[model samples]
Target: MSLLFAPFKLREVTFRNRIVVSPMCQYSSVEGMATDWHLVHLGSRAVGGAGLVITEAAAVSPEGRISAADLGIWNEAQAERLRPITDFIKAQGAVAGIQLAHAGRKAATEAPWRGGQPLGPERGWLTLAPSAIAFAPGYECPREMTEADLDQVSVQFAEAAARACRAGFEVVEIHMAHGYLLHQFLSPLANHRRDGWGGDLEHRLRFPLRVARAVRAAFPSHLPVFVRISATDWVEGGWDLPQSIRLARALEAEGCDLIVASSGGAVPDARIPAGPGFQTPFASAMRQEAGIKTGALGLITDPAQAEQILATGLADMVVMARELLRDPYWPLRAARALGADVQWPVQYQRAKLG
Candidate 1:
């Protein structure tokens, strides 16, 4: 039997297979509301046979958005719009998940296709971070977060998690990766504060961990809370494997169910050795050292490669992004390649391979 097709459970949720759709921003929302585009974009992956389909990082607050068009669940109206999309995913026998995020200093930028530059004052709001730092030279300098701001952001994340549950999602992955708000605090490269929230590793972890605890508490107890973390900043003396392992352990202690191990993005210029399965080692190390379930992402395209990652105990699940975009039915194709018997949608039964 292929491990890739095996069911994996966390809390009361059971994924039909090991394949997960990594959250990729759609940059297709209006005033933080989900549209039909999100429904068709996310629902198709569930129909294509993924075990879990995670929506793109949904900003917990309006100002947390990466771009003007980024998805949001900051209010009840936005959460209601997500209900239909999650329902469709679950109907297709896939677990629905959402990634809660805050872009911090990276907020208020144009979409990637539109040059991805920072927006001017007319179109942008002040960004917030551990310190008043810019992600890159061209990016806007963020305001140093006051204690009140920290408290408010934590409440926002908790409320967002509660709303995601009401919207029918079974999993909530906190987006602490990709140089966003939580990640900004995690990496010394972006956080330069001398206060209790940023001087050392433990201090740097304070706010992110507080947010994780709040989110885990707000989400349903029977559901799983996953945190996506940049295992390393990929910059010297920045956030690295040791720090990530410690963070994973801390998250686990706070009731987080899994760590989705990804790397870099804290800084724009850090050198990352990008290739197939390049990040599995970080997941492997975290699982071994931190003693928590982990999902390996980053360039995980092939079925054999994904299977091997789990088969050898490198990670618990394989999270795919670009490859899944290229073929939403990659899981079905992988089932055939691994000789695992998987069910196809009734409408597509005739196309099922032997």
Candidate 2:
């Protein structure tokens, strides 16, 4: 039997397989509302046989959006629009998941296809962060946020979690990775505060842990909550594996069900040794050391490679992004490639070999 195709359970949710449709930003929303593009984009992956289909970074607040067109769950209207998309995904026998995020200094930037440049005041507003810092050259220097700001933002995340649960989502993954808002606070490279919210590892972890606790309290206990974190900043003196293990343990204490292990995005200058499954080790390490389930990500492609990951217990689940975009039916195809039986949608079952 293929471990990759085996069912996995967390909280009250049982995934049909260990394959997950990693959230990929579409940059196609209008004013934070998911349009028809989202329904089709997300629905296709569910129909394609992914066990869980997670949405792109859905900002918890308007200011948390990475781009003006990012998906949001802050308001009822925005959450309401996601109903049909989630319904379709569930109809395909896939769990509907959403990643709640805050971009911080990364906010107010154009989409990648638009060169990912910092937006002008005419298009984007001011941004906030733990400290006044810019992500890179050409990005705006964010304003240092106050304690009040932190408290309010934490509440925003909780409210977003509640909204996501109401939007027909069964899973909520907190986006704390990729040099976004939470990671900025975790990495000393971005957070240079000399206060309780930053400095040493304990201080730095304060806000993130607080947000996780609040989100857990707001979300239903029957469902699982996952935190996507950069297992390493991929830079010297930045967030590394040891720190990540500690953070993962702390998150687990805060009721996190799993950690989606990814790396880098703490800075643009870090040398990332990108290769096939370069990050799988991080997931394995986190799972063993932190004693928490982990979802392996980053450059992991191919059916055999995925099966090996699960077979060896390198990760509890594997999230795929670029590959899924290239082939929405990848999970179904992967089952065929592995000689494992997986159910295809009724309309498409005729194409599967008897």
Clashes of each: 0, 0
lDDT of 2 by residue, 1-354 (tens): 998899999999999999999989999999899999999999999999999999999999999999998999999999999999999999999999999999999999899999888896678889999999889988878999998999999999999999999999999999999999999999999999999999999999999999999999999999999999998988889999999999999998899999999989989999999999999999999899989999999887899999999889999999999999999999998998998888899998779855
CA lDDT, every model vs. true structure: 0.95, 0.94
Error of 2 at 128 (Å): 0.6
Candidate 2's error at 7, in angstroms?
Answer: 0.7
- Model 2 whole-model lDDT (C-alpha atoms): 0.94
Looking at model 2, the pairs that clash are none
Range of the 10 consecutive residues with the lowest summed lDDT in candidate 1? 345-354
lDDT for 259 (candidate 1): 93
Q: What is the lDDT of residue 304 in candidate 1?
A: 91
